[model samples]
Target: MSSLKSICIIDDDKIYTYGVSKIIKNYLPGNDVMSFENGKKALSAIKEMEQNNDELPDLILLDIDMPEMNGWDFLNEFQSIRDKVNKEIQIFVISSRIDQKNQEIYRVEWDQKVDDFIQKPVQVEALKDLLA
Candidate 1:
């Protein structure tokens, strides 16, 4: 598998963000890892990077629920600017609210927009498999 150059995690939970970032760093040392407390911050930062012609993240793990701008809102905003992006981005929706109905809805509405929908408390093995 190809090594990822950078990763971004958009979530409000500090513990989950820290744990996921640590796992990513452990697997891909020297990789660029960024975390945001909400989608609004992540979206703004990404847009700024685009405007500056700076490097963008290779992957993003987004949470469904957040204080400012949820994952769905982020995706909608991202779609508008996706064509202007300098690099390809792989997005994964990571949420703890994965019931059968929610899973079905995600599969129907976001299957093509995102790479995958993963349950929270994201595991190293699962991440390794996906990243691999």
Candidate 2:
């Protein structure tokens, strides 16, 4: 695939963020990769960028479970901001907690907004495919 302007990852796990960011940089070095510890921090940064009229990331990798604002909350709040941004941002929900209960919740609550669902411990080939 052609290079994206930027990609954002919102997750509480520092190790996962670092590793995934590294992989993206290695494979798509031209793109900017950003990470946030949780949804709240990510939303703050996103709002700041929006206020500044800055270019937002083309893609967002979101984690389902986190402290200080989880993925579901982020998605709900993001919808309003998204309309004002005038940019098409693809949101991919990446989580390790896709049990039956959560799957039903996601299907019922957010099936339309999310571009895709990626399970945690994402495989290298799958990541490549995503980038491609």
TM-scores, all models, native as reference: 0.92, 0.91
The global C-alpha lDDT for each of the candidates, from Candidate 1 onward, is: 0.87, 0.87
Show pairs that collide, candidate 1.
none
Q: What digit string (tens of lDDT, one per residue) describes model 2 on residues 1-132?
A: 676668899999999999998888887677788899999999999999999988988999999899999998999999989988778898989999776677777777787678888888877777777776
Tell me the tens digit of each residue's lDDT in model 1 across 1-132: 557668889999999999988987888577789999998999999999888988888889999999979999999998866777656789999999987788888889887779888998788998787677
Q: Assess the local accuracy of residue 52 in candidate 2 as a C-alpha lDDT between 0 and 100.
A: 94
60 Cα displacement, candidate 1 (Å): 0.4
- What range of 10 consecutive residues in model 1 has the weakest lDDT sum? 79-88
Q: Model 2, residue 56: displacement in angstroms? A: 0.8
